[model samples]
Target: MKKLLVLALVVLIAMVSFAKEQILHIYTALDENEWPIYVKAFEQATGIKVQVVRMSSGELLARVEAESKNPQASVWFGGPAIDQIAAKKKGLLAPYRSEAVEKVPAAFKDPDGYWIGIYFGAIAFGSNKEQLKQLGVEAPTSWYDLLKPQFKGRISLAYPYTSGTSYTVLAALVAIMGEDKAFDYWKQLHKQIHHYNTSGSACVTQAGLGEITVGIAFAHDIITKGIDKGYPIVLTFPKEPTGYEIGAMSMIKGAPEPDLAAKFIDWMLSAEAQSLMVKWNRIPINPEAPVAPGAVKMQDVNIVPMDFEYFGAEKDRLIERWKEEIEYGM
Candidate 1:
């Protein structure tokens, strides 16, 4: 009788815990002003409340790892897919094949359904017009132009360790300049820094406000957040092939709201949600979605062929090297 009573109490506690988690929880790496737009749409469509914890991809990965034993969130939304790939190898994600993702290109998702790409973007330089004018320099037309003697201590880039956007740039440079040369290039570029940022988009905001002469950022962000917003900022791409990020989403391994999480994923991949991203200038991966009016067409830019498998596998080793050699000095 005592065992039966104890079991009843245990079952009641489980029921309460499950009820508490009916409101879906998510870990997201989407920009601050960006995620709310999607969340609003999701709640309206599904009547499911979402709880979000926002962090850059690197920090999100660390948090997910820490919580692996007692998983907290139901989903992870919006970050460089490479980080998602890293998470998949560690058994941190649940595989769910959604019909909404069926039309997404193979290049943007794992064949086995671990992660799905939402959008993709290229790297570019966001130049502060007033700052550049004062310094007598036109917007840089090439990556090397930022290295000119006049630009020293005037360029901003986020910390690669903390910012997936910055890591995408680092990997792109590696693809463009070879491993050793890429490190050397960054070492040179490092001396031109005006302190690194923790959040990737913060540097672009700094440039838009003329706090710095230039900030290395994604082209879509430069367009929507800096240039189109009427800030005194203009974006320019590298003459050589540069890196791009395939922003991805995934379901958590032990999601409390498994069915709801799966629904959220399908909802996000729906044409409705994908189309909504265009207002922010993100080119959605759903082929059915329209590209933003001023979105940079990949064909027009010399894009590096990203090896997701290699880059995802090598991210930790590369980040460690970057910290030792470029960020903190070897």
Candidate 2:
């Protein structure tokens, strides 16, 4: 009986130790190349185990909504800020204003502190020069150029419903050409689209592989992950103003580990943490943190004026319209 009591005590101690080492779950919209580095750094700094599942921003939001009652993730990281705003409106995010918030620019964060921007990148066309040469097509210089017959069945884009990058493109078009004209533009451009991809970066990858002549994605991704890797792709911004995404992070509402998640948020905003984005060719939200070499400075790009709150509110309506008018008709 005394030996049995010792065994039970040892088992209890083991269980307690296992519970203390419980992993912090993260639902991330960051690319796979970026997340592992972040997870490693975070674990090394905090001594907390992290398990991450990577998905597109829209998919991540859907998962968060589906699991709202019993949240599975402690945080949502590295998605467009507009998605974060939409999540906040749905009460999926917990508001926690970190001390690090003061270090971020006012334009990069939510006014109510539901989410914080960690980085930003601009939308551009990633064209394969060899593919374009083979097709006798010039690199597209404007959004309108994408509608040319030569581009037919050679352009790849992500569906706006499933991709933050594509949503940003839609929002930019509306802001640039007005809503009515933007829809009309998409109808014309639809003819050239070879396929609608689920992942934003996948289109760029296809372009790099020469499977598509042109891909609509973030310029930073095309440059670093595509061209730099000898994929024969070249990045070009539309002569018209382009949209940019302020990639953000937020604490999940009712997260199992809110305190630990908050700590992670604070750490992400630090200069040391933000600088890690350089490894993935992402610009850091903290001004003091240096960007990756070859990153295009925001000032050099003709960025469209984006109203995050307005776009966040209108996303559902716009997506529904796109489905009916563009996707269905296509």
Q: Output the number of the lDDT-best candidate.
A: 2
RMSD of 1: 3.5
lDDT of each: 0.89, 0.90
Report the C-alpha lDDT of model 2 over 1-330, residue by residue, as the tens digit: 999999999999999998788888999988888788888998999898888999999888889999999999999988798888888888899998999899888999988889999998999999999988987888998999898888999999898988998999999999999999999999999989999998888888899888899999988888877888889998898999999999999999999988889988999999889888888788888888888888877887999999999898888889999999999976
Q: Per-candidate TM vs. native?
A: 0.93, 0.95
Any residue pairs clashing in model 2, and if so which?
Answer: none
**Lowest summed lDDT over 10 consecutive residues: which window, candidate 1?**
292-301
